[model samples]
Target: MADDSLFAQGMATRRAVLGDAHVDNATARTTEFDADFQTFITEGAWGSVWSRPGLSKRERSLVTLALLAGLGHEEEFAMHVRATLNTGATPADIKEALLHVAVYAGVPAANSAFKIAKQELAKRQEAAQ
Candidate 1:
């Protein structure tokens, strides 16, 4: 773990944002081939980007949602939708983000994201109940 403060911070942030169960599942599923990929995201995405103080976690959450939507990353988008609870992004915020996605990224991406978001939201609601 030399020269790996970012990785450590990223790992902690990832766990907090994604939850212990989700992080554990990801770790458990990591194979030799993809281990490096996971490490890079952990350090770069979680540590360097997410840990930055420039943007609040809530704001980052919304931006991430839009980007994921725009890029058609359905599974990742849904997982992030679930992360909103920890990041403090409300449903209204997500709705508004998707609106931006529709305008800038186009209707199709936002449309599909909305469907995925709805399903994930429903699942969260059900789990809460």
Candidate 2:
């Protein structure tokens, strides 16, 4: 059985990092088919690894963003691009990571990720004062 305390802790941390509104919208968008997957991510990814003391949230965010971009997960890449703002990762850092992705992952993947990041960054900047 999933640990309720762990799940709760993960949910709290997830909200803090990802923001309540984003998490709420994600939760609201979850369907029955993906319910288990969502729980696994909450309890496993967030509760387990993210709660560990090994890495700062900022480091984890950087790794996660790079992996998403490298893997060509555009949707997740966009979400994490916005998430970097809260994790203290500047747009320059993200651009640098995408450049690295271009070298290691593939130019096409990096290009797509950069496009998504640019758009997301623009939206985020506009939302700010």
Candidate 3:
């Protein structure tokens, strides 16, 4: 079925972008109530949008960071910040995106995003040590 194939593709892309461990943990936590929501995000966000060819994963990652920060999606912004390693989005890239978020979204949103980003990036640095 088309939906099945799309879900498969979405899973692959999601794993690629978010990494297996992250995807596995999310899959493990899925419940009946949120199962459909998970599938929808996988199929719609990962398969349909992320899988598109016009933008590289890095570009997509930066854009996603900015949007999440702009909209004050703290948890998701943090998750995506962690995902930057797999997405090839450098810290510099994140800084630039957050700057854009400040101008377009608001200083308060960007300020919160910057704080979260700093914490995430610091955690990454500590992990590498």
RMSD values, in order shown = 1.2, 1.3, 1.1
lDDT of 2 by residue, 1-129 (tens): 678988898898788778999999989999989988888999998898888889988888888888999999999889888888778888888988888899999999899998999999999888985
Per-residue lDDT of 13-46 in model 3, one digit per residue for the tens? 9999999999999999999899999999999999
- The residue ranges of model 2 lying beyond 4 angstroms of the native Cα positions read none
Could you tally the backbone clashes for each prediction?
0, 0, 0
- Residues 16-48, candidate 1: write the lDDT tens digits: 888889999999999989988988999999999
Give the TM-score comparing model 3 with the true structure, all chains together. Answer: 0.97
For residue 7, model 3's alpha carbon misses the true position, in angstroms, by: 0.6
Q: For candidate 1, which ten residues in a row score worst on lDDT?
A: 1-10
Candidate with better lDDT, 1 vs 2: 1
On TM-score, who's better, 1 or 2? 1
Pairwise lDDT winner, candidates 1 and 3? 3
- The per-residue C-alpha lDDT of model 1 at residue 61 equals 95
* Per-residue error (Å), model 2, residue 70: 0.7
Ranking of all candidate structures by their lDDT, best first: 3, 1, 2
List TM-scores for all candidates, in order: 0.95, 0.92, 0.97
Residue pairs with backbone atoms closer than 3 Å in model 1 (clashes): none
